[model samples]
Target: MKESITRYQFISLIILFEFGSSIIVGLGFEAKQNAWLFILLSMAGGLILYGLFTRFVSFYPDTPFPQVIQILAGPVIGYILVWGYILYFLYISARVLRDFTILISQTILHETPLFAVSLLFMIVVGFACYLGIEVIARSGELFLPYVLLMGGLFLMFVFIMDLPKIERLEPFFNIGVKELLSLVFPRGVSFPFGELIVFAVIFPHLEHPLNSFRYGVIGILISGIILLIISVTILMVLGPTIAMNSTVPLLDTISLVNIQGIIQRMDPIVIIIMVVTGFFKITIFFYGGVTMLQYLFKLPRRKSKGLIGFIGLLVMTVSMLISENIAEHLKEGLEIVPLYVHVPMQMIVPSLLLLLLFIRKRKIQKK
Candidate 1:
């Protein structure tokens, strides 16, 4: 709770978190070969949504999101809203944990119990959360370069093998104005970009809050660009239909790398990216939930140590119980969660908070 992170660490964490399960599942594939365009428009929407989130934080830059809610909404209403976000964060942490669990069970550990994989992964995540935000941020700073290198290598090998078929992207503008715009708003922006709302907790931990906010925006832009490149690569290589249909398009793309057989079977690279980025994603969500609890109850640093471990178990259990299988999980995430959960927590509530803050500021000025 007493920890402080550097600006570089903040940017690295944002990039790593954004690159989480979203990359594994891919985004904007509804546009088919022109999924890149879909992603581009979504990133624009995400940036605007992010500006709204950060603007709310700017009113109370020194405070964490939980406290900001209390100040803006008053204790009764803020208490309810803060608790909602707390559960929301933990629920999402569980969801992402389930995401990696399914990926590992399907790809690497076919025979392994999904519960076993989640437990092992959650152990490391729990330990990291126990350490605090500074440690998490530092780990992200250390790993961001490695992630970039591995991601770059994957892209490089695809071209080296001459796999991309630019022709697959023919009739590029086939998407209607309505269809493209439909995908961009709630679906495209919500999943990865709107998820940055969790960073409101982490933002208050930064050593230089004002400057670090700028880095965070830059981090989102960089992640968006990386996502765009990956989307285009998948479309070019696997074509629109295949990329859209595949559960893990990037993994499928990497599986196609065959250079004289020696440079093939690069599934490990995708797995590594999934594990590393998923860790950051789940841990950040976990941390946000725990941070809210700590702030709510006024828990000391000593008490939060136990809370972290307890919450970790809760998240793991909820992950398994959240859905019947991967199909159900993805279905809920795609259709139900965005409209029902994400819009309220990420967009509606925050927008309302901003409005309240504006009124409060004017009243204070009048006084």
Candidate 2:
């Protein structure tokens, strides 16, 4: 039987996945005190991109993403494109895994090798993948509340300590409209929202596929609001200069919480957020790639441990080998990947696909 998930599960996954790496890295630092504006703008951009995705999925609710590609683009070209997405998804999976392991190494695991942390992390994520998307959805549902509660608690502590000074957000429009618009595009939107492209594979599994769009919209808005609050909090607490300069802005923001020094060092809260959201993010991409490969070769859903194992190993290796160090990894992610990889995959391709779909629909209606 094909695995399916409820509408609630679907919403949970989207929220958790959106929260993924976005929380850890922070967004729109270029705008400084006005970083919140960037996230708010990017939320709109994310909704537009998401509308494209859910619209595409709606065209073929029951079909796998690869098959939809073949139907839309023809067999040969679609086969090649499907392979491209498989590689893209796997590459992104590796990138996010690297993101998490780097955080671990920098924080608590200072003495441990990154390779060891990554290996262990990948093993758990890979196991979850092997169990299937149903497992992933269920896990997301189970963990969503815990993640939200911890996040809320952290915020409460920050406020209790009176760390956030609303005055720090003075001179909100530090940059002009044109300059601020540039900061939100491609990079700001790409990191978290554009990454939702991978969910094309999972949308087909929703029990009520027609409602996927509504769930997705709600999920993004909820997560976006949460992120907006956090981003503003970071800015207000740390001030624009320090928040902009900090590597992990959220971590730094949380570390400052001190209730008479007794409730100090809330770094673990950030760590938990990273580990949970990172797992969801990486595993979704990993599953997308693995699922695409399975569909391409017409493999049976059951008894695919061998393929999962091989792909898991590949993801683990690529995570470590992708960059020389955290600096290089972040540099590639911030500077290089957004324009070249993200813009093409997340923006251009989807726009073209939607255009073609429109043309095809018109032709059929004329007949």
Candidate 3:
């Protein structure tokens, strides 16, 4: 059976995927006292980069990056590029799995074995992948609206808890233009913005390839705005120092909501939202990894699913090995190595591919 997913479903997955990992806790650390400002700046830059990427995709409608590289750079060079991307995707999927497992163990199920949590997540995600992209996209579509609504309610409650402090957001540029710029455009035009590179892999699967640009841009914008609002809420409610120090600022903030003691202890609801959002996010990375492997080795049609599951199990194991402490993982991920690893992968390589494609197109026209 030829299964298909609509463009909206894909868009929802992308949105949820981006929001999953760091939207709540990431700002708690990196952005700190000026979390909202940092997010706004990051979003603005992210949108610009995303626009550039989408334009590149639209330039060659239905052609994924791997194919584009092959045509422009020739098979030898293209295969190398594809191989690098495959490895990158595998690494990212592993890291995200580990991070999510850590969160669940620390907060919700303290008694659960880490391996058990990782295995259960793999089983569920593996099943989704086995069902194919269409099934995964449908799940994203079904859950996205509800997740958004729940997120909205959470924000509303945050506002109710601390309305007066909303003004604390004023004096917007007080963090110094340099610091703000650093947070937004860190490491010379790279950072989180470069993450839009994954769209290149999935472009062929988009229902409306032409409109992928629009939808992709919209997805980043929506997610960015939500992140900005979330950062602001956490800052106003928890204050700068505490919010920065908190492992789960949103959860901490939610725990403070009393509503006459009846509506208290809503942290569980936030955890539910985390699980849902994280699932979609991790699935996208996992899908990207699997697809890359299939394309790289030219695996048999049906065997790709089984192979991908085995690969995912390895990824989970690697995640466990990467760190003994959550703080160390965050330190390495944020401060030590992301700029070095992600920047070249996300920005440098793709930009080179685009350039090569343009040069090849010119040569063909000249002939």
Per-residue lDDT tens digits of candidate 1, residues 1-367?
A: 3579988899999999999998878988878866888888888888888888888656676888898999999999999999999999999999999999999999999999989999998899988877788889999999999999999999999999999988988987998899888877788889899999999898777787766557877998899999999888889999889888899999999999999979999999989998899999999999899989988889875667778888888999999999998788988988889889999999999999999999999999999
* Per-residue lDDT over 263-302 for candidate 3, one digit per residue giving the tens place of the 0 to 100 score: 7788877888888888876777777777777766877537
Error of 1 at 30 (Å): 1.5
Model 2 residue 319 lDDT score: 90
Candidate 3, residue 208: Cα displacement in angstroms equals 1.4
| Span of 10 residues, lowest total lDDT, candidate 3 | 185-194
lDDT of 1 at 228: 90
| TM-scores of all predicted structures | 0.98, 0.98, 0.93
Model 2: per-residue Cα lDDT over 168-198, one tens digit each:
9998677898988888887888878889999
Number of clashing residue pairs in every model? Answer: 0, 0, 0
For candidate 3, the C-alpha RMSD (Å) to the true structure equals 2.1
- For this target, which candidate reaches the highest lDDT against the unseen true structure? 1
Candidate closer to the true structure by lDDT (higher is better), 1 or 3: 1
